[model samples]
Target: MSEAYTGGCACGAIRYEKAGAPIAALHCQCRQCQQRSGTGHASYVVLDRRDDLIVRGELQTWPVAGDSGNVKHNAFCPICGSSVFVTFEAMPEMIAIHVGSLDDPSCFHPGMVTYAARAQQWDRVGPGLKSFAEMPPG
Candidate 1:
């Protein structure tokens, strides 16, 4: 069996573990991502099911309208202010965890770049990965 994915907030106030593989991994260059990460982009690993994922500690969430017009709940550690994960109002069963929050961030293998149209020149993504101007259709 594949090893579980584990991670938490920088302050140890929040933690999470997922039992299965990720659904997708990508770097988002949307304006909100840039602002939240204080960088050109944010990396995430999308999980297909939220039911089996175990989480500990309180996460403060802020609601924001996504570029797709859907509401996204951005969850973070209230104490450390470290963004941890995001949940979609439209896709409640799915969850996207920040790659930086992972215990072993090297496990992230980004397959694509989202919001490439908003990507900054200084934060260029690798040329080999597929990129989309906006969120791609599933």
Candidate 2:
């Protein structure tokens, strides 16, 4: 078995352990991501199977419509107000955790940049990554 991925909120109010490897890691520059992260972009490590992730502690969640018109449920730590994870209404099996919430953020190796058209010039990622003007086709 692969080593588990462990992490939590800034104040340790919420914690999680993923038994499987991440399906993908990427940076999103959509307006919602920018606003939620209080930055030009937000980084996430996505897991294909929600069952692989075990989360503890109460998380506050809010629903927001994505550019695709699908509702995304954003989960955060109420104690520290740290954005922790997101679950999509359109893709219930998937779970995305913020890279900043990881115990070892170095494990994140972003493969792509989404919503590049909305990306701010000041928040540029490495030039070598694949970038899409919008979400890539699945």
Global lDDT of each candidate = 0.92, 0.90
TM-score of each candidate?
0.95, 0.95
TM-score of 2: 0.95
Q: Which regions of candidate 2 are displaced past 4 Å? A: none
lDDT by residue for model 2 (1-138), tens: 355778999999899988666777899999999999999999999887887678899989999999888999999998999998899999999998899999999988999999999999899985799999999999
Q: State how far residue 23 of model 2 sits from its true place (Å).
A: 1.8
> The CA-based lDDT of model 1 is what?
0.92
Candidate 1, 1-138: lDDT as tens digits: 355889999999999998777788999999999999999999999987788888899989999999778999999999999999999999999999999999999989999999999999999986899999999988
- Shift in Å, residue 97, candidate 2: 0.8
